[model samples]
Target: MIRFENVSVTYEDATETALHHVDAHIPEGELCLLVGPSGVGKSTLLGTVSGLVPHFTGGTLRGRVTVAGRDTRTHKPRELADVVGTVGQDPLAHFVTDTVEDELAYGMESLGLPPGTMRRRVEETLDLLGLNELRDRPIATLSGGQQQRVAIGSVLTPHPRVLVLDEPTSALDPGAAEEVLAVLQRLVHDLGTTVLMAEHRLERVVQYADQVLLLPSPGAPARLGDPAELMAVSPVRPPVVELGALADWSPLPLSVRDARRRAAPLRARLEGRTPPAAPAPAPEAPVLAQTARLTLLRERVTALHEVTLALRAGETVALMGRNGAGKSTLLGSLVGLHAPTSGSVSVGGAAPHRTRPAELLRHAGLVPQEPRDLLYADTVARECSSADRDAGAEPGTCRALVSELLPGIPDGTHPRDLSEGQRLALALAIVLTAGPPLLLLDEPTRGLDYAAKSRLVALLRDLAARGHGTVLATHDVELAAEVAHRVVILAQGEIVADGPTGEIVTSSPAFAPQTSKILAPEPWLTVPQVREAL
Candidate 1:
């Protein structure tokens, strides 16, 4: 059991405490989920368990933290390594080996385990994560999702009693994410391992949690309870499930299958309801920002083939594909971060590769997949205004625009100090303030809650409506359905499918249909659409 008795942590060089005087207990072998908007010290709480809070990361501490009856204050991270294993959001930062097989065996080898036991454990871990095919492959060559699994596998092979994971599925596509979750579920059930995970993607893991620890916001207290009970009160509640409850359904459905089952009767009752008249149809043959035979090469690999595509003005396009299938690379090519080897990539009648990085900022605004690397300023407001200075725009205008998107935070606070959701919002506001005609967002909703996602959808929809072309590379099919007018699927660095939102989602096996589509897989991407379709 992991217990915190009035534990409070305050990092040096910060004015406020990260975690308040908090008391919580995680029972043995319980699949406890640590959830909140972001930054509410969820990660800090997990760090305390593994001796990261006061040991690796120096911080003022009060009270005590005990794991399995062992006092955490007495044991540093290296001392607790045998009992606790942790996987952070950034997996690559913790890697100790170059290959998957070697990485899995590194932990056991460090503990002085015999060669035979280490080999067996490595084999078991590889099979558990379904990474046997890539056992000998280079760690750098693996996709983001695969790397996340390898990180988990590397730690799990040590047979640690407690496994702490931070946002494990934030970087994964739908199919790959399911595989990782399945492996984690098996660990809790079959190995009797205690799991404590902090994540923003609640819809994927809420049903599996035995206990939910909900934090309100930064520097605030956290609430703990059964997963289902907490979901009802959560500000970032899952969309379909929340809609089901709003519509007065009995025993709220947690998964798509359960949602379908619950909605079946409702569909029958509402079958005869008349549909509202259709709104004026958008123009046929929409004029898109055309890319004529675009080709890109990264060393020997072809990042993008001679691809011809069109992204219509005032329309949202979802760019979907397997990881390492060049989703980010394509976004980079369009923003002049990477020059194409052949052909041309254009946005708003100008070639991005030919334009200067500063000049390109005016035509297309890009939000990279990893938001941390993009942030350089000390404060949130300063980060937003950095773009203004770069583009020769007024700082006052930039501050006003950022305030409009994210309201609660003061302009003087540090950007890194804010929650993950808030940081994402701040970054997006900066990008949009540049007044670009085209926008390229790569996994912009990665660490956000449902509430933040809703705000993002509204913002993107408004931007598209205002005649700004938008392209979003994302794993959240649900977000794509709600905001995007069109969907394009990429496989092995080539366009495999492209069509309207409804058609591509329903047809693709690689893609999991959105909740709205799962409820009603035709002519719609929302709950209202499902209700009306019935």
Candidate 2:
């Protein structure tokens, strides 16, 4: 069990407290979900459980925090490793070994468990997380979802009484995310493990939470209660919850099945009405980029096959697929991070791989899967300044854009200290400063909440309206449905389907959004679209 009494945290340089007088108790063997907007201290609260807040993070803790009756204020993360296991957003940052089996055993080895015990736990964890097939693969070689499972398995091997996860399923595809959530459910139901997780993709996990913790904003007291009660008032909500609210359903439905069961009348009301039409394809638009029979291989692995694609100005393409389906790889090829082993790729009439860095920025700008890769300055102010100089923009252009995208982020804040969503916003501002003809974003909504994601959707739409070609690789089906003009799906390094967004998503059960699933055969992909129809 975890308990926080008048707990508050303030970093060394921060003026505002990350958490404010948070008093909550998470019962043993229960799964508690921490929900909040971006930069609202969800991660800060999770860190307090494992004593990472004041101990390793160099912060000041105000009151008592205990895990399994041990005061976390007095104990360090290492001291509580036996009872508390924490997995952060970045799985690569947590790994100490090269392969899956070794990573799983590393934590136990550090805990000084006997070799026999460690070996048995490793095998058990691999099986529990369904990583048997990838047990021998290098951690770096696995897809984002596989790496996430490996990260969770590495911590689960220790068999800690309390498991703390931050954005555990953000990187996973729909099926893999369900597997991870099911694993958590089993841990709570069968193993009696206390699971505390923070995730932005509420549609995937809210239904499974035993209780919900809402941290509305920084310096605000937390709210803990039944999931339905909190979701009714929570600013950040999943599509199902939003739909329930729209229909005025009592005890807002948290899952798709429940919402569907209650949607019969609404379906009847919508029987004769048609959903809004998707954007018409622009057959006469100029081609801004093209890849002809592109093939890419890395470490004897075929990441992308001989694939041909084209992006026209004013088009927004959503590249979607399962984990390890080469979405990221395809994005990389577009930005010249990976040169095609065969065929050609052209953006703005030149090969991206052959163009210089500065010149490349003129033709295309990429916001990679890891947003921090594009950020290097010590402070946000300097990062903006550097972006301005590199792009030859007006002195305040980057800063202005940052303000528009991430509003309240302080200029003095360290880039590393910003939340994942904030960091992505800053990275996106830097890329947009260049005014490139083509834009590439991979998993842009990884840590963004509903509000931030809405702003992103609007920004992308604005860019598309300005005749910029945009390609986004993401697993967020709702996001793709809302923003993309076209949808392209890839599988096993080959293009499986490419067409208008409505056609590609509504036709496929696996790719359909929550609203589409609830309003079955209705051709609706979002809550807004359904609301418009009604």
Candidate 3:
């Protein structure tokens, strides 16, 4: 259904090619997963299939890319719309309409389908994606997860033969991600639809993939094989695979069930041993931020409701929950983006909402979910310099942080041209340059690979050790387990659970990391913990 023959892509004025001599064939009805490290051109490869690389992105494409037997070189994205549907990393950017129902119908309308067919497809997609109740709601009011579903439903309504999704489940909760993957599985098995997805969260999708495509590095030949075969040598791997490797399991387990079945001996080895304890703040540590009975309403929706919380110095707290569970709202309240309806939010003894921008930066800094929102300069150098000036840091401080967080990103490269993970690293460096007492990161690891995530974990740990309080709102259970001292779960604008990371993650199946799940009843939340235990 999809074929790339001697394909290589290079952006305008770019030194490195995004993809080099890539040759791969994805058969009809197969769910092919594109896996690689951050900035390795996974997105670029996906764009080629939809004719977005050289066509809309102003790049040079050599060789051929054909989808459903149609040459992408001759067809633009709009021309290939009927054959390929692409949903990018940012769902908000994909929406062209205001309401959920309108968004779903927009694609079909663009294709000039019969009104009856459009309506029928819209209804069918709404039901298939579990968006029935939200069909009449405005797109902006929906939670991040809801917006993701709408974005996907919009593309699926057109009934395209090929679906190209970039990080489709990045913003979704575990349960919601499963639902989306299930729909993809149905499309592949029942309808013989071709699905090509690029995702950083391999643990969630690897098991479902019929074939795996590994892009080891930018400008390198792509590898195609069975999931287990590719995973065995892939630099970036899911936690389950890592666990299987650590335990010397003959064949690496892709899914939790398979891993658990092979974990009987490993489980017995750790039966009585306790997992290492996570670090904790001192009992007398000062409070860096506090929220008392906070309530926030947006467009008549109670985003946050009478929520009380506190952040202590030298502590890293992870805020987790399903989509629309108010995790972002809580971060907004702390960062002064949203004012509470009924209660108070204090950061460093001053109200965040009333705090000046300069003052707020000194108190706390926020790296929003959309990393581009905080980036405006044309070049990476300028952005880093601006961050230094804004944070009153040394001239090269921000640049140095960027190097530490994301190396190999050229200083002269346009911020817009960077990959999602590289952009996030730059944004994070901008925030960290301030050296604020409190750090706020929302979904910080969205596009990061395992190596980048490990670097971020180390950075967060160092910050907490230096008495900087950190609050991370994320759907990454693995990240929470790695860096979070305490995990706070929110649901429907209320705090549902708050405790130590080990305690909170192990108690809930949905929120637990792969290591915790594999070593059930043992409280091991990470591979390192398991390794240390043995």
Candidate 4:
């Protein structure tokens, strides 16, 4: 269905080749997963398949890429739209229409499909992606995750033979992500559609992949083969594969069920001991932020309702739930992006909504779901320098933070040219330069690979230890298991559960980390915890 022949890509004004001699093939009706670290040309490779590289991105393509036997070099993205449905990393950029239902039907209308067929496919896609309640909502009013689902449904309604998705589940919550993946599975198995997806959250999709495409580094040779074989040697790994390696299991198990079948003795070894987790904040700790009976409305929809919460010094909290469950709303309220409809929100002894931007900088800083929003400077150096001046910090503080999170990023590179994860690291560094007492992150790990995420985890742990309070809204359960002292679950614009991380995540099957599920009857939340226990 897809083939890459001696593929090499070099962008205009770029010294190093973005992709170097990547030769690969995918047969029809197969689901291929593209795996690599940040800035390693995974997106570039996907762009080739969709004809976005040389056609739209102004890059030089030295080799041929074909989808369904049509050469991408000879065809543009629109010319190949009938056979290929491509969803890139940013959902907002993918939408051409304003409303959910209209966006879903737009692709089919472009294809000149009959009105009846378009309507039927739109309805089927809405049900398949669980988007019925949001059919009429403006795309801007919906949450990030909801927009992502709509973006996917739009392409899906066209019924393209080959579906190319980049970070398809990045914005989705655990349940929503599963639903989206299930829809992709049906497209591959029942309908014989070819799906090529690139995702950073491998734990959620690795088990479902039919074949794995491993790109070890930037511009390296691509490796494509059985999922199990590639996962064993891939630089990045999911929790299941990491655990299998820790236990020295031969060939490594790809799913929880397979790992469980071989874990009788391992369970015996860990029967009496529990995994160690970061302790929750002390009751007497100084309050950095708090919300009292807060209610917020957006587009007449109750985004947050009668919610009361608190964040204390030296604490890291993870806000989690299904898509559009008020997690982002709460974060916005704390950072003054959204004023509450009723009730009160205070940060650093002042109401965030009423505080000025300069004063609010001392109280809190936010790295939103879209990292690009916080960055406006042209180059990496300028952004960092500007952040330093705004925060009154030393000149190199932001640059050093970026180095710690993502090393080797050039100072002169345009922010737009950086990968999603690289852009996020720059945004985070800018936020941290202010040295705010409270830090807020929405889906901070969206594009980060395992190694990048580990650096962030360590950095957050260090920040908490230095008496800063952190609240991050996220769908990455593995991250919460590793770094959070507390976990708060919200649903339908209300707080449903809040407690120690291990207690809250382990109790809920849908939100539990992979290691916790494999080692059930115990509250183990990470592979590192299991390794430490042994």
Best by lDDT: 4
What residue runs in model 4 are displaced by over 4 Å at the alpha carbon?
none
lDDT of 2: 0.90
- For each candidate in turn, the TM-score is 0.90, 0.98, 0.98, 0.99
lDDT of 4: 0.92
- Per-model C-alpha RMSD: 3.0, 1.3, 1.0, 1.0
For 1-534, candidate 2 gives per-residue lDDT tens digits of: 899899889999798888888899999999999999998899999999998898889889999999988999888888999999999988888999999999999998888899999889888888877899888889989887789899999999888999999999998888778888898999999989999999999999999999999998777789899999999999899999999998999999999999999999888888888777656447999898899999999879999998899999889999998888898888887778888899899988888888888888898899988899999899999999999999999998999988888789999999999988999999999999999988999899999999999999999888888888899998899999999999999999999999988899988877889999998877678999878877
Better of 1 and 3 by TM-score: 3
**lDDT tens digits by residue: candidate 1, 153-209:** 899899999999988888888877888888888878987889999988777888888
Span of 10 residues, lowest total lDDT, candidate 3: 515-524
Q: List, in order, the clash count of every candidate structure.
A: 0, 0, 0, 0
Report the error of model 4 at residue 126, Å.
0.8
In angstroms, the error of model 1 at 319 is: 0.8
- C-alpha local distance difference test of each model: 0.77, 0.90, 0.91, 0.92
Worst 10 residues of 2 by lDDT: 273-282
* Candidate 3 per-residue C-alpha lDDT over 1-534 given as tens digits, one digit per residue, 9 for 90 to 100: 999999898888888887888889999999999999988889999999999888889889999999988899898888899999999998998989899999999888888899999989988998888899888999988887889999999999988899999999998989889899999999999999999999999999999999999999876799989999999999999999999999999789999999999898999998888877767999899999999999999889888888999899999999999988999888888878887888999998999999898898888899988899999999999999999998888999999999999899998999888888899999999999999999999899888999999999999999989999999999999999999999999999999999998889889999999988887877688998888888
Better of 1 and 2 by TM-score: 2
Give Cα distance to truth, residue 275, candidate 4, Å. Answer: 2.3
